[model samples]
Target: MFSNAVKCRQIHLIATSIAHYWPLLHERPLSTLTTTAISQEPSMFVTSSIFIILYCGLSLMLCWCDYQSGLLPDRFTCPLLWVGLLYHLYLSESTLSSAVWGAIAGYVSFATIYWLYRGLRGYEGIGYGDVKFLAALGAWHGWSVLPQLVLIATILACVTLGIKIIAGRKRQVLYNPLPFGPFLAAAGLWCGWQTLISPPP
Candidate 1:
């Protein structure tokens, strides 16, 4: 009876050892699993840094072009619109339909104001290029951001124009056409930067 009991205890010990090491024999090492998991996710810091550099650089270039030439070329705005749409397509942060509607709303809103101002005042108040630029920005930021964009741009434009008049010391009212693209680009950049820096809830 004692001999049988000893044999049973020995068998139990062996079975316990096998169970503990079963994964070692059948599965990959823990280090490999860790490496694979790390590789799957992107670092938000790196992605945000790259986005800021590229987007802000592009904004500055557009600002310079508009300030100097009073034009936001199709070369810039068209690519901007396509890239925004593609970003939404791949990232899935926003729906493609939202972007399309945003673009249409941006263009139509500005065009309506432009035509109404022309009819009432007998001159163009804003350029067609500004309309396209706003549409591109809308595509990038979606329709929800358009109202804020316009409000910020308008406020800044008014403030800047006031400062310029004060600086020039012109007592009489001077109705000079100012390039609106820079204000729009600046407001767009501010919105983008805010979005990037804020943490997701």
Candidate 2:
């Protein structure tokens, strides 16, 4: 329910914070930096830690909001997508073209499935928010990681559904709408973290 102006302000703050702190996060040799270095340069270490904490915190907020409200506001998803693109652009870890294509492919793939499902079933089977969330993830990780990301998310969601049905002890549980955002967020976080530690070639 945030106003557009408020959302813009928030995104600006986040972008500025990242621009200020991100270089410190990568300033050290991640593979070689040790406890001695961390103790010597606590400010740099703490700033880098804060950046990741904020990143994960924002993602968790999105997951919680989606689960509770069944809505993924453009405020959160748009910033996520744009920040990811900017991250790669600033770091040059991946081509801008790759990130752009990843975003497009992610959005289009899910959007197509969403429409097809609605067309055949006469009702929405997938939320538009999920499409946006996936696109944000793609912007962070690129298209190559999407298949595995989706597969992991699907399995987690299915397992959760199965557990729900069993706990309820009812076959009718299949009709209930389950939120998929949490699973997607979990998978996205894992994939993103992996890429951060060991970037793709």
Candidate 3:
């Protein structure tokens, strides 16, 4: 955990204390509270939705911080990932080995593509941020859908490039680093859902 995260957590604690003591504080609960007002239990979908929203918001902030500070801070990213992986491991206890291998496979697939680009261009093609994101995705969803992620990312990039070309915004076929992480993550989720709903041979 990063130092800033520690400070942020402390601030949150103080705010919670203030909110708790202040009877005037009245934040509406979005879902039915369990047995107590302080149960801290929302509907599962609501909780998942909030988590996803927070992840995207944090990812945007992290991306901006990376652009500004030239470094990826672990404050938000690491804890969320660690907890997510544990959640995943617990949910798929019988397939823990598959998840571990899937993570490795996802990393290898993406890293291999990354290296291939580097070799052909003789320059740094992908950044460590992308590498880490892919690794995290691997850990989250495993490797079975990694190929779909790559395919979808490529199609999205091509479509983006096509639009740029059609609009006459640029001249060269420059392979700019777009936010491929989101597409990969989204595609993996879609494919994973499909697989879960329709198991195959």
* RMSD after CA superposition, every candidate: 4.1, 20.8, 19.6
Preferred candidate (lDDT higher): 2 or 3: 2
Candidate number achieving the greatest TM-score relative to the actual structure? 1
How do these models rank on lDDT, best leading? 2, 1, 3
Off by over 4 Å in 2: 1-51, 169-175, 198-201
Q: What is the lDDT of residue 151 in candidate 2?
A: 95
Q: Estimate each model's TM-score.
A: 0.75, 0.71, 0.57
Candidate 2 total steric clashes? 0
Q: How far is candidate 3 from the true structure (C-alpha RMSD, Å)?
A: 19.6
lDDT of 3 by residue, 1-201 (tens): 699999999999999999887654443333334345446334434554554555456556555665465444567446535544654554446555555676677667667878898999987566555666666555555566667767876787678778888988665545444555555545555554654332221
Q: Considering lDDT, which of the candidate structures 1 and 3 is the better prediction for this target? A: 1
Model 1: how far is 77 from its true place, Å?
0.8
Candidate 2 residue pairs in backbone clash: none
For model 3, name the residue pairs that clash.
Answer: 102-143
- What is the C-alpha lDDT profile of model 1 across 1-201, one tens digit per residue? 999999999999999999999988767677688887687445644554554565566667778999998888888888777776665665555466777787889999999998999999998889888888888888767788889989999999989889888888445325547899999998998887655344222
Relative to the true structure, candidate 2 has a C-alpha RMSD (angstroms) of: 20.8
**lDDT of candidate 1 at residue 32, scale 0 to 100:** 82
The positional error of residue 103 in candidate 1, measured at the CA in angstroms, is: 2.2
**Which model is ahead, 1 or 3, in terms of TM-score?**
1
Where is model 3 more than 4 Å wrong at Cα? 1-81, 172-177, 188-201
lDDT of 2 by residue, 56-122 (tens): 7657888998889878888888888887777567555546677778888889999999999999999
